[model samples]
Target: MKDIFSTIKIQVNEKIYVKDPETSALGRKIIQESILLMEEIGFDNFTFKKLGTKINSNESSIYRYFENKHKLLLYLSSWYWSWIEYKLFFATTNVDDSFEKLKKAITVVTEKIVDDKATAHINEAVLNKIIISEYTKTFHTKEVDEENKEGYFLIYKRVINRIVKLITEVNPEYPFAKSLASTIIEGSLHQHFLRDHLKTITNCDEHVSPTDFYINLIITVLKK
Candidate 1:
């Protein structure tokens, strides 16, 4: 199998269109506009026709960029992961202290989850159900294509692995480092979906900021 980084690099480098610059620009525009629409109407209600109409293009033209809604969604999901990875990498790079680095890592991940623009389009309750159903179904109902799996793992899973490694390195006695790291990461994601209820549950009258909460939680756990 191709190395994941190499594969992404190649995909990024490959020219999507060889002949028409105008067509290539239009194709990219369609995907960008579609992403914005998805952030507005959501994936279930969003359609190629609506996207084309929004962008003042014909429905047929969208096929030049995405073969179908699924493909377009896949690209959008990948883009989100890629964006998070870039932010995490940059945020953690300059921190020399292992504990500080780990805190920074959690902060970056939590902030991305709490980003307003990214979360605006989807109704949290319905979106969470769809995500859980689709993710669980992906493992069983569909064959796990190695290339796609690698691409996804690279963009998403690797970030968590790096954080876990950092946690273990900072304090080897940190019991259940792997499990705790997963908790911190996944908990932050779940918190975003349950933000309103969580605020009420925790008796925090104001919105609970994930970054501050995650950093504080990690520090408390590590000091214990």
Candidate 2:
């Protein structure tokens, strides 16, 4: 019964930020309130100037941490995937059945996020809203290749890698483990986004559980 988060660190790459937002009060406030404000206004309209105003600080102060909102988004995304990877590991660690482990991982990612008091400084539930709403923007840029080389996405890569391993465990002969794993991860989150906006386009029904469709999706493909 080890407290997994207590023993692990969510490492956002140094290249992504000028200051580690976890280090100081102002830094932590910037992260905490940034998650709040991003959820409130959406990432496209979010600005350090507005954030500074809300936090009662100078806009220039945000640069002491992030170079710009793009990098900030990446930092938030990295933290999220790190948290997710931890959760997936924690959720499935003792399961003997590979397919069951994979199902649990899918549920952890595709389902609702609950606030964990262990990391009270962060409201992961609100952060998941931003993540589901905006995570793709973190890499849909010209600099993605260079940033990839800097190891800016290792945690994200690791999550996929872990899922891929589970996929292989379930069907050692399967040739599409990586592809299927990525599809489950990205497709499930994308469906969650659609559930909020174009509910008609989504297969998930709230009364049945937000994760039901996605869990069925991966299980069907993996078991087949």
Candidate 3:
């Protein structure tokens, strides 16, 4: 899967960037270094000027690829979800059992991330941290509805809908498939954040994973 993923280009919404950052050495550098920089400094403190200094390019050059840091974060967020969507599809494909397939899909989304060595420029582990920590900033804005209209969040929504389909397959009578699918996705992130920071509140620690909790919850909720 890693080899196949290395060959696949994760596409983001074109409206998110002035230029695609995956196209050139410098462009890719902006993305590669930006991820490291954002993870190091957090999104609120991240800037094109800081990225340019880290990449040894002028601030203006960064703008050639991204209009501003907000758009860059959007590109990163879209790219991360697109990659996860690929993994979710591949992980659950051709499974014969509906319940087992649903479990696999849940595992794909909830498990701890590790760096995919296939994508040299992007670190999946660090990117997952960004998604867990900073992802809300991408959409928690006044421009979100307009951006949603522009299809900026399509891939992320597609991911949840895929699991929603699997939930309905497992239990045709389950009327809350959409809500449950979204909760599993969003709640997994929140659980991970709690485990890392506010450990007392969440039961997802080293021994008990978010996957374990969600899988158990799904079984109890969907069992006939």
Candidate 4:
């Protein structure tokens, strides 16, 4: 039999999921339905049994792919970070100007996501909402230290590292490149949530888009 896992396009680390959800129909169903179930019902009420029922599969079948719901969330979040890094890579690669490259990369993260069909099982749009609301839970848990040691955050680290490199290229003397990189990524995620749900608290002005605010902030700080 041909190996389906080998053909799966997205390069999420094996540490994220118990099994590669892309390798089999049941696994794919687990990921596809879990995203909708998590988004619709909220992660607090989402469960393996509920997801299984939604997919017409059993709880154990879903467990074959993910250890538990937290792992499932981690898997989705990892996939998203990996997807973001891919978007950043392609978006900035052809640009010769360092400032333009930096601005373009910022746009990729801060701008609203359009539906991407390349990774069909995971709805990037819905998943972004889930990430905004639930991604922190994956890292803020008691087991986070253990998970971090396992390279569970490689995709996020990869994305931050790339941004840090770009910042260094633009401002070689910047002492806080990595710190600024993380601030942009994490702060942008939270700012996005605030902009949508608690508009008054966000740093963004009504006249400027969220992407504009983030791009301008980074440019002002780094383009010395």
On TM-score, the candidate that comes out on top is 3
TM-score of 2: 0.94
Candidate 1 residues lying further than 4 Å off, grouped into runs, are 1-23, 112-150, 196-207
Clashes in each model (backbone N, CA, C under 3 Å)?
Answer: 0, 0, 0, 0
Specify the highest-lDDT model's number. Answer: 3
RMSDs, each prediction?
Answer: 7.4, 1.6, 0.7, 3.8
lDDT of model 3 at residue 157? 97
What's model 2's lDDT at 121? 74
**Pairs of residues clashing in candidate 4:** none
Which scores better on lDDT, 2 or 4? 2
Ten-residue region with minimum lDDT total, candidate 2:
1-10
1-224, model 4: which lDDT tens digit per residue? 01432244777778767789988988887888899999999999999998888998878988888888988998899988888887888789879999889889888887777667666677889999998889889899898898899999888899999999998888999999999889888887888888888988876655666788878787789877
* Model 2 alpha-carbon drift over 4 Å, by segment: 1-3
- List the lowest-lDDT window of 10 residues for candidate 1: 9-18
TM-score of each: 0.68, 0.94, 0.98, 0.92
lDDT of 2 by residue, 11-94 (tens): 888989998998999999999999999999999999999999999999999899999999999999999998998898889988
Model 3: lDDT equals 0.94
Candidate 2, residue 197: CA error in Å?
1.2
State the displacement of the C-alpha of residue 34, model 1, in Å, after optimal TM-score superposition. 1.6
Q: Compare candidates 2 and 4 on TM-score and give the better one.
A: 2
Question: What's the lDDT for all of these models?
Answer: 0.58, 0.86, 0.94, 0.84
Worst 10 residues of 4 by lDDT: 1-10
lDDT of 1 by residue, 15-101 (tens): 222222123567557655665676567666879899989989899877766666665655444444555566677678878988888
